[model samples]
Target chain A: MSVSGAVSEIVAERWVERTLAAYPAEILPFLSGEHDRFRNPVGQVIQESLTTLARELLGAMDNRATAPAIDALVRMRAVQDFSPSAALRFIFDLRPVIAEVCGEVTPQLESRIDELALMAFDRYLACREQIASLREKELRVRALSPAR
Target chain B: MPETLVQIEQKAPRGDWRDPHVEFRKGSICYSAAAKNLGALSLPNPRAWQPMDADWKLPPDWKRIVLDGMKERLKKYRSFRLFMDICVRCGACADKCHFYLGSADPKNMPVVRAELMRSIYRRYFTLTGRLFGSLAGGRELTEDVIKEWFYYFYQCTECRRCSVFCPYGIDTAEITMMGRELLNLIGCNTNWVLEPAANCFRTGNHLGIQPHGFKDSIDFAAEEASEITGLDIEVPINRKGAEVLFVMPSADYFGTPHYYTLLGYLMLFREIGLDYTVSAYASEGGNFGLFSSHEMMKRLNAKIYDEARRLRVKWILGGECGHMWRVLHQYMDTMNGPADFLEVPVSPITGTVFENARSTRAVHICEFTADLIHHGTLKLDPRRNDHWIATYHDSCNPARAMGLLEEPRTILKSVCRNFHEMPENTIREQTFCCGSGAGLGTDENLEMRLRGGFPRANAVKYVKEKHGVNLLTCICAIDKATLPTLLEYWVPGVEVAGVHELLGNALVMTGEKERVADLRGELFAPEAHSVGSASEASHA
Candidate 1:
């Protein structure tokens, strides 16, 4: 393997690790340990999403590639016990992890990370809105229709 | 930033699994038991207390109360005593819990969750734990331990999926129930449980729907069903000489999707010309007390038999509900019965006596409907449900506690033409919980419900992607109430419904108007290549 490719891979692996660190320490083991997609959807999805996000950032920095992974992670986080800042906080962790692993993050990569964070925020808002609408729809149907 | 990253990454794993520490995150916990609800039931130590607060305002003798309560329970319930002593931490049940699978929290693992209570039992009761302390995996009953108990015990939905796989046959649901009972002793409880139980005790239903309100809801459902079927159905309320008393969770009359099932029940009963009465006095079949305390469970469950005897009904037929069946099938006779006043449930339409329910004298609506269909008593047109490529979710209690694995499926397959099963393991005996059962279905705990529902939703997602499945059916009221929200969050486009709702759609009611829509007011699609023929061709 080429030296640059190996370097990028190490940085991406570190990025995934740093992203997982944002969650509570209690669940860290299972999130990283369990590999079965059905048994550990949250863990598998979080890890896979971060890995994909890292790869997308390192490659073409494609919005199409990164949006889905970000959507999956952000959807899980939005429903969890996370404040908006905390939900989006992991996105910020990527820059430092990349810099520490490779001694530098290129200017283009830094901007891409920022763009990814913005997309995550958008997805997070969309999920919260969806939850609100779903709850409203449920309440409407749950109300006694004929009694009213 | 780098220092913070290092700190986050370098944080050591928790010291031991036995350490009593719980973080009360906002979305993960339930609201505290309302003081009024506890006081209404004459429970001890009624006070408003937040779970997040350091001072739980527990009684001064909280520790003694808990240990003594545990001692009394240990003597009374042999299963509890056996389960406490029997577990070997085989880890067979670890991944079986929906909460553990969803959140990946080790304590959510069934073994670890049970151990949270078992560890306290060890330190207080076992000789080795008393002598060796930490070495023997014993944990002291600190305030933090009580706090942890409240956190984790409530997290369990009491679905009992873990017990299905346990080699020692440890009933983790009982352990959770025991843990909750002990928590209640210290006035540590959730309002999601206590309020409904208190309401059930007072007004005879969880929502505290008074007799008039209950009648109104039933009248409304019957009216809607009459409009759909063009038959003016007679819904008897508190009739003294009715042969069977029909009781279902109050949610059926009020909650969405559940209301449609109520319509289904009304239409099916009318079509069959069965002699039945809907009692406003016994409006709820769900016993939230099962989630509270054993005594509370017994107190709440007695009403079913009480109403049956008072109304002089020969037998009782329960509507589509989950835990309601569990209590009726498993605990009702022992807790509230003999029920000698009620006769064995003999299906009037099919003449099939429910021998399985001869003791309890109560039959599930699925069993009743399945029997009728089996005897060819009702004419069913499966094509009515052809628009729905459906899959069935076996509600935990009905599937596990009662072993009601096939009755609902028999009915669903008979009614829905385009039906699919989820992955083999995620259905029937090994079914995944909707994650919002056991009084944890409150909006405050929505995040945990979603997390807990992920595995169920994942399986649904697989079938949805593979078969274009758009409907998820179950017979539980709680499933009807919560699965819609869970599916919307995790697997959008898959609507939730009750088995009987589909049955209502398919059941050709006598003198009924030409049907164009299923229950829930959704229109059936035009016959543009029927899914029935396509699915048959694929099978062929």
Candidate 2:
């Protein structure tokens, strides 16, 4: 199997196992809510990105259509407390994941990693711009608010 | 090979509740209701302003006004005092809240959201709180506290799921209502709610359609229903001596998805041959005034009884709606009731008595139909719904407040072949809000609605991925209008429909022509086309 597909699987299944440990025991129990992704919609979203990222790397797909979906996740991260490096850091995590899964092709996946990071960063900024516009709108409404 | 990827820690360093630095967040907060809308509704202290602003333009004595408002409401609603005093902070209600579960903001927890108001209640009302202040969790009724009340109170849809799990039955809805009542004294309210309430009060419908306009819209829908059902159905409007006075959300008359549900109502009424009249005077079943203060809600609710009395109907047959039924079942009886003038609603077709709604004498259309289905009165063709693998979204108010859960599902199972449920926690009693509910369903507040809707949307996404369920059928008119946008964003391609809309597709109407296309002009079934050709020949 290609390293990207292997990386995708590990992220969806393998990495998710470890990431689940990141939350507290208080939050861990809610992973079973009826909506399948109750406590971990982001993990599903992150897992969702792997296939498209993997597909894009193999020259079988373009992220143009997929960018909005990816950007949605990035937008959440950007507005959240995650620092810029930390927010975009997940894209780069796939590189080492691939290396561990298929050690022979770690260097081969570098360009793909770089490309995905750039796209993610661009998407994050776009989301940030949307949030900024909303914030601006809120301000405008405040300014135009009915006076006493 | 590079070293292995490490798992990112999910927990924050301190696990703090309040982040004072970003308290006025752009993404997480809701926008204020506009001035013109509030003015039209004739709300007290009406003025437009954003919650994020430092200056809310309160009156000179806003503090006294709010404190008095709280004192008045506390005396009126024992639930308010009970909610304030009973909470032991056990946090069973923490994860139960959809807002907290979606946003991970600790303040979104039901206990904390209620605590915002409870804190003020403690400071002003309790002796220990008056003495100890912040030490006893009593916060002064500062302008910031008012701002917080406006922010969080609007954030709540008042679904009362928090009260369901509370041991003392301390309803957060009571707290939120008291918070909003206090906010109203300070001229803080959302425009989306007030405008609709104002419009409904003025024009007899929330959309502000005049009598002729309301009639024209229903007639246009009746014409559309004629196309689907191949029968000329005359929907009675404002005719006296009708056995039933039918009402639904005005959205059903004007919009897609909802309009189909409107068609469902028409076809079902025709098949049963029930004598029912739709009222242009009391045209709306869904009350936006429910989201506003109780006085406004009572004013809006008075019309149903008035119209029902004027028209001299036997009982009210309510259409598919969420908060509408919450008002009809829970509040309407107490507010403007003793509906003694009307007879207890027994289904004309099945002859089943609705004992649960005996006092209000209002029966949900689903409960009416579920009896018909159970009694083998209506011929429902389940094969007509082969195109849709449906899932039920229990709109919050009906499920939690009234327990009107089984009737809709019973009808769905009888009418549709493929039915799957959302996760147990997300359906019936534990159902999440449509995000835009409780008067938050406006375009300007789309971002907050989207954020608020994430948990519900996430659940739909899972069912789409696993069950290949394409249709998200609900019983709420607000759900019909808002859930489409929510689903389109989070789980694209999963279309929403009403429970009646599905029943419309599956209803075996008397003496109907050869059916090929379902409502929305889609094919009856993908595979049925081959067999349909043979049936066409046989019918000819």
Candidate 3:
């Protein structure tokens, strides 16, 4: 196997594993249970997105794949009862997981992880904006007179 | 790679759920009921309070009043008593709740949510509990327990998805209703529920729209429908000599997506030439009182029958709504019944007898429309709705409470060519809630609503991925109001519409102008709605 291919597999598995750890313990069983997409969507989304993210982080770092994956996972977290740090900690936590698995932090991987974090931050803000906008829309609709 | 990654902690310590220590977060809970609303209803212990405040300013003897209320209700309601008594705690219902499925909060599990009340019942009402106390799985009633009750009971949308899976057939929604009623005695209620109910009792509708305001809203919708259909549609409101009285949730007129459904109703009524009159006095069919208490539900629901009597109508026809149908189907006849003044509901156009609603004298609009289609009364061009690849969401009350499963699907099949069903576990009798039903749909509680709605949205995402489904048609007014926001958050591409909106789009109205756009003013061009292109289509 190529050195990068081996690194991607190891890093991807570690990333998914550490990310699952970040959820509350009560939810851990559901998140780590047998992967049925319909039955366990939160877990399924997290796993699928993280797997794609790990691959992208290690390889091409394609925005097309990475942005949606980041969006899917972060939107779920954004609406959950987590503070800003706690919600985004999983992204930042990836740095240490990669280092621990590889025994040394490569500058290239470090830069890629930083870039992924910025993408997640952007997604987090967008999700919050959508939520606030939705709230405003609901209030407008709940009124007696139509805006039109 | 190591066997495990990064010192994994497999088991997180589980805390005692019976501790009754609830942390009131900002978005998880709703604001307390306003004093003016409670006083408007002449309800007990009306005072301004917040869930986050240390003092709820409950009655001086709140415990005594609560226990007394529970005692009286247990004596009166056998369903509530049976639900409290018969739980085997088999955990069959633990994961069935959407909130539990989404949030993974243990207390949200159906068994535990019911147990929040059951444990207290075991302590005071049952023999084993009074004797053995903690040993009998009972805890003393404290102020903290009341807070926990307020927090968790409102968290439940009264969906009853769990009751479907239970071996003993426990109706958990009734238990929630009872819990809220008990809370109401101590004036522990949410403004979202009480304010609307107070408005409903006073001005005849939840939004407190006076007769003129209600007429203006309906006139606006009728004008919009006329413009869309090119037919001059005239609606009769509070006409004393109408054949049938139509009652809709106020949101159907006031809310978006819901307003589209109203336009659909107007077009259908006009096309069929049915002699129906809309009642502005009994304007709202959805009883927020159902969320408050049985008595309040009865008070708010009495207006429908009263208006039917005043108008000398044969029967009542209810518009698309969830809890409204629940109140109409399960409780209305019992609560305010012997509508002996009204005749059984039979469709003037189809001549089909609604025998199921004969006693209640209130027919669902879906049942009526489905009958019309069955009889080949209205001309429908399904290609008009070619823009939508649709799926049906069976609103909780209609599915579990009333068994209104097939009528909506039958209507969708007739109106739209591209139709798909969500996963078997998530549709038709086993369907999940919009998570904001039963007065939980409020701005302050958006986070919990999002989490609670996750399961339903997840299922929608499955269909969106598999079939490129763009439209979710439901029969509930609350579903119409809340599911749009829920989809916007989780599954962005899928838009929410009432079943009638699609019907309106597809209905080939007589003497109607040539149509260029669907009911929401979107183009009917199939090219604009290619499969998998819904992600880019923005809905107003």
Each model's lDDT comes to: 0.85, 0.75, 0.86
lDDT tens digits by residue: candidate 3, A11-103: 777777777776557667767884867667778888888888888887899999999999999998898767666677788778787888788
lDDT of 2 by residue, B1-540 (tens): 434335544444544332222355555565666777677766666665677787888888999998888888878887777777889998778776766665555576789888887888888899999999877878877777777677778888787777778877778877777777778767788767776787788888877888998899889888888877678888988999999999888878876678888888898888889899999989888887777688888999999899999999999988888899888888888899989999998888777888987899998888888888888877767777889999999988878878888989998887788899988877888787787788876656666676677778878877888999999999887888778766765677899999998888777777666577777888878654432232322110
TM-scores for all candidates: the values are 0.91, 0.84, 0.92
Off-target runs (Cα >4 Å) in candidate 1 are: A1-33, A58-62, A81-104, A129-148, B1-15, B528-540
Residue range B97-137, candidate 3, lDDT tens digits: 88887776788888998999999999999999999998999
Local distance difference test, candidate 3: 0.86
The candidate scoring highest on lDDT is 3
Full candidate order by TM-score, most accurate first: 3, 1, 2
| Top-TM-score structure, candidate number | 3
lDDT of 1: 0.85
Q: Please tell me what DockQ candidate 1 reaches.
A: 0.35
Provide DockQ values for all models, in the order shown: 0.35, 0.17, 0.33
Report per-prediction Cα RMSD to one decimal: 3.8, 6.3, 5.3
Cα DockQ of the candidate 2 complex: 0.17
Error of 3 at B182 (Å): 1.1
